[model samples]
Target: MIRPMRLVSIEQILQARKLLEGVTRKTPMEHASDLRSLHGGPVYLKCENLQRTGSFKIRGAYTRIHGLSEEERARGVVAASAGNHAQGVALASSLLGAKSTVFMPERAPLPKLAATKGYGADVHLHGAVLEETLAEAIAFGERTGAVFIHPFDHEDIIAGQGTVGLEILEQVPDVETILVATGGGGLVGGVAAAVKATRPGVRVVGVQAQDAAAYPASLAAGKPIRLKEMHTMADGIAVGEPGKVSYAHVADLVDEVVTVTEESLSRAVLLCLERRKLVVEPAGAAVVAALMQHPGAFTPPIVAILSGGNVDPLLLLQIIQRGMTDGGRYLKLRLRVPDRPGSLVAVLSRVSSMGVNVIDVEHSRISGALAIGEVDISLALETRGPEHCEEVARALQAAGYTVV
Candidate 1:
C-alpha cells in the first residue's frame, strides 16, 4: 500500500527555509496602517503576492523539484494547476534545468497559461476543472515517464510552504496571530505546524471562500471530504476536496478555519487596490475579507498573507464594478419621466448638481411599467458611497419623479 506524506516536521520547514534562501524571495511583512487603527492593534500584511510566480506556490514547487533525484529530473516532471502552481512548477523546472509539462484547465486565466509556457514548460489546456486537469496530468506523467508533481499534499511541498511561517516568526517575533488564505490546505497546514511548533502561543487561522470551502467539512468529518458543487471568485483556492496529507496537518495544527463571503472578498480586493495600492486576487485577499466581516475577532499583532496577484484583467474589471456596487458607490435607478427632451436634461441637471457622475443613461418609451407619454428612464450613476447614494435617491424623489 502506498502511504501519503503527512506531518511535515518543523526541522524540514527550517531546512526548506535554507534551501529557499536564494531560490524564493523572503517576502516582506509590512504593517497595515488602516487595519491597525480600526482594530486598535498592530496588523501586518505578508506580501507573498510580490513573490516570484506571483504567489507562495513557487516556494513549494521549487523545493519539490529541487529534491528530485538526478535520474528523476532527467525524466522531467508534469504538474497541474488552475494557474498559480502551473507557473510555479514551470519556473521551478526551468530553474533546475529539467524539462517540464503543465496541464491547466481550459478556463484558466490567459496570463497564467502564457506565463507557464514562457517559463519553458510545454503547456496543455485540458479539462474544465482542476480535478479533471490533474487527472490528465497524472495520466500523461505515467505514459511519458515524467514524475507527477502534486500541487500540494507532499511533505516536501508542506515544508516549502512552511518557510513562510518561518519568515513570519523571524520578521515579527511578537506576532500573536497569523491569517493565511486556504486552498488545498498546503500553505495553511504547513504554516500552522511551523508556527505552533515554535510559537505555541500564536494563533494560526485559515480563511477560505465560503462558496467553495471544503476545509470546514473535512475538518468536521475527521478526514478529507469532497464538495458536490463549488464556485467562487477566488479561483486560486477553489478546491473541491482538501488534500489528504495537508488536511491531516490542518486538523491537528491549525487553530481555526474561517470562511469569507464572495461580497467580502470583492470588497477586500478593492480595498487592497484602492487603499494599499496592491492588486490582490480574491483568494489572496481572503484573509482581509475575513477581517472585514468580523472586526475585533482576532487579537492584535496579526499578519494576513496576500497569497497571489494572478487575477485575470477582465475579471478584475468585473470585480471592481461588483465591489463598487456592493459598497453603494454605484447606483442604477429606473424612473418614469416625460418623454420630452427637456425632461431628460432636467434629470441630468439634478444628477450633476448632486456631484454624482453619470455613467450611462437610456430612455425607453415603450416599457410595460410606463403609461402613454411616460418614458422609462434608466440612469447609472457613480456616487461617493451609501450615504451619497441615499442622498441622491431622496433628491430625485423630491423632484417628483417616480423611482422604481
Candidate 2:
C-alpha cells in the first residue's frame, strides 16, 4: 500500500505562519449582514479573493518554495494549474530566484495564462485538460531533475494552506461552521487538518461543484475515485479526482462534503457582485452557494471562504448578463406587427407607459415569419424586476400584437 503523506502537523501550520509572515496577506473576515440574517447565523466571509495573486494559493506556493533545499531550488521547479495556482507558483518561484515551468491546459483562460507568463515563468500550453497538463509537468520534472511542486498533495503545500485555517480561527473565534470550496481538496484538506487538530469543535465542510462531486463519491467508495468527465461552470472546483494526499486528510478530518449546482453558483457570484460589491469567480462562490441552499446548517457564526477572483473578463461579462436576465432585469421578446410607421411607435408607447426602459428595438423584415404585409420585431428591454417584466409583457399583449 502506498501510504499517503501524513506529515502535516498543527505545529507545521503554525510554523508556516512565521514563514509566510509578510508574504501572504492576512485576508479579511468580512461580516455579511444580509447573508447572516437570511441564514439566521453570523456569516463571515474569508475574502481570499483579495489575497496575494488574487487567491490563497500564494500561501502554499510561497511556503513550499521557501522551504526548498538550496540544491533543489537551484535545480528549478515545475507545477501545473488552471490559473490561480499557476500565478502563485510563478510569483513564488520568481521571488526565490528559481526557474519555473508552469504547464497549463490549452483551453485554460487566456487572462490567467498571460498573467502566469507575465510573472516570469516559462508557460507551456499542453493537453486539452488539466489532468493531462499535470501529467506532462510530472514527466518534464522527472526528465530534467526539476523539483515537482504538487499544488495540494504535498505536505508543505498542505501546511502552507493550513495557515488560512489558522487565520480564520483567530479572526472568527466563535465560528461554528467553515465552508470551503474543494477541487483537489488541497485548501479544505489543509484547513480541515488545522481546524480539527486545534479547534475540534468547529465543523469544516467542503463544497464541490455538483458537476465535479468526486470527493463525495470517493467517500462513499471509501477511497479516491476518478471521474470519467467533469462539467461545471465553476471550473476552479472541477477536479475529477481527489489528491491521494489530500484525500486521506479530508476523509479523516473533514466533517462533511456537500455539492452545489451551477445555478446556485452563478447566483452566488452575482450576489457577491451586486450586493457585496465584490468580484468572485464561480469556484470561489461555491461556498456561498452551498450556504444559500443549505440554510440553518450552521448555528451562530458561519464562515465561507471566498477562495479566488481570477475570472476571465469575458466570462464575467457573460455571467453578469445571465444573472441580470435571471433577475428579470433584461428581457427579450419577439412580436409580430403590421408593416407600418405607427406599429413601432404604438409598441414603444405601450412599453414607455409601463415605465419599462427600452434598451433596444429591432424590426427584422428579413428573418422572422412575416405575413404578407406584417413584419416581426424583436424588442430587448430592461425592466425594474419580475413584476415590472410582467407588466411590460401584459402591456405589449394588449396592443394587438402577437407576442411570443
Candidate 3:
C-alpha cells in the first residue's frame, strides 16, 4: 500500500525558494472576481499559464538542470515531452548555455515543436505515442552520456514545481483550497507538499482528465498503476501512470483528486476564453472544470492554478468551433422531403426567412431513411446562439414538412 504523503518541511521549501532565486517567475495571484461570484465564493487564479514557455514546467526544469554537477552540465541534457515540458527544458537549457536535445512524439503539437526549436533544442520527432518517444529519449541519453531530464518523477523536479505552491501561499494568505491539474502527479505532488507544509489545514485538490486518471486507480491499488490505454482531449495530462516520487508526495499531502469529463473540459476552455480572456490548453482547463462540476466541494477563497497555454493553432481553432457548437451557435440536422425540383428551394427559403445562415447543404437520394419518393437533406447552419437555434428549430417544425 502507498504510504501517506510525507509533509515537506518548511526548511525544504525555504531551500527550494533560495535555489530557485532569479530563476522562476513570481506568477500572479489575481482575484477572479467573476469566477468567485459565479461560484458564490472568493476565487483566486495562480496565473502560471502566463509563465515562461507558457507553463509551470520551467520551474522544475530549471531546478533539476541547475542542480546537476559540473560534469553533468558539461555533458548536456536530453528530455522527452509532447508540449510544455519540452519547451520548458529547451528554454531552461538554452538560458543556462547547455546543449539540449528534445524527443517528441510524432503527433506533438506544431506550436510546441516550434517553441522547443525556438529555444535552441535539437528537436527529434520520434514515435507515434509519448511512451515510444520517452523510451527513445532514454536510449539516446544512455548512448550519448547526456542527462535525461524527466518530465516528472524526480525529487528535484518535484521540489522545483513546489515553488508554485510557495508563491500561492504568499499571494493568497487566506486560500483555503488549492486546485491543480494533474498528469503524472509531479505538479500536484510538489504543490501539495509546499502548501501542506506552509498551511497544515489548507486543502490541496488535484484534477485529472477522466479518461487518463491513473491517480484514482493508483490510490485504490496502493501503488502507482499503469493503464492499458487512455484517451482524453487534455493530452497534457494523458499520462498512463503516476510518477513514483510524485505519487509518494501526493498520497500524503493532497487532500483529494478528482476527474472531469471531456465535455466539461471543453466548456472550461470556452469559459477561460469568454470570461477570463485567457487562452488555455485542455489540460490547463481541467482544474476550472473540476471546480464548476463540484461547486460545493470547495469553500470560499480558493485558488485554481491555470497551468499551461501551449496549444496548437489548428487545435485551438477546432476547440473554438467545438465550443461554439456546444454553446448552440452551430447546428447540423438531417431532414427528409419530397424529391421534387422546388423542394430544395423551399427549404432554403424557410431557413433564410428565419435569419439562419446556411453553411452547407447536402442532398442525397440513396443513403438515408427516406421514402422512395423523398430525398434526404443534411444541413449545417449558423445561428445567433442557443436561443436562436431553438427558435429556428421551432420555425422549421411549424412548417408543413415534418422536421426530424
Off by over 4 Å in 1: 1-6, 339-341, 371-373
Residue 254 C-alpha lDDT in model 3:
86
Off by over 4 Å in 3: 2-8, 30-34, 335-355, 363-377, 384-387
Rank by lDDT, highest first.
Answer: 1, 2, 3
The residue-level lDDT of candidate 2 at 384 comes to 81
lDDT by residue for model 1 (134-213), tens: 99999999999999999888989999999999889999999999999999999998899899998989999999999999
Using alpha carbons, what is the TM-score of model 1? 0.96
lDDT of 2 by residue, 236-260 (tens): 8888988888899888889999998
Q: Rank the candidate models, highest TM-score first.
A: 1, 2, 3
Q: Model 3, range 26-83, lDDT digits (tens) per residue?
A: 9887677767755678988788889999999998898889888989988999999998
Residue 322's lDDT within candidate 1 is 93
Kindly indicate the candidate among 2 and 3 with the higher lDDT.
Answer: 2
Per-model RMSD to reference: 2.0, 2.4, 2.7
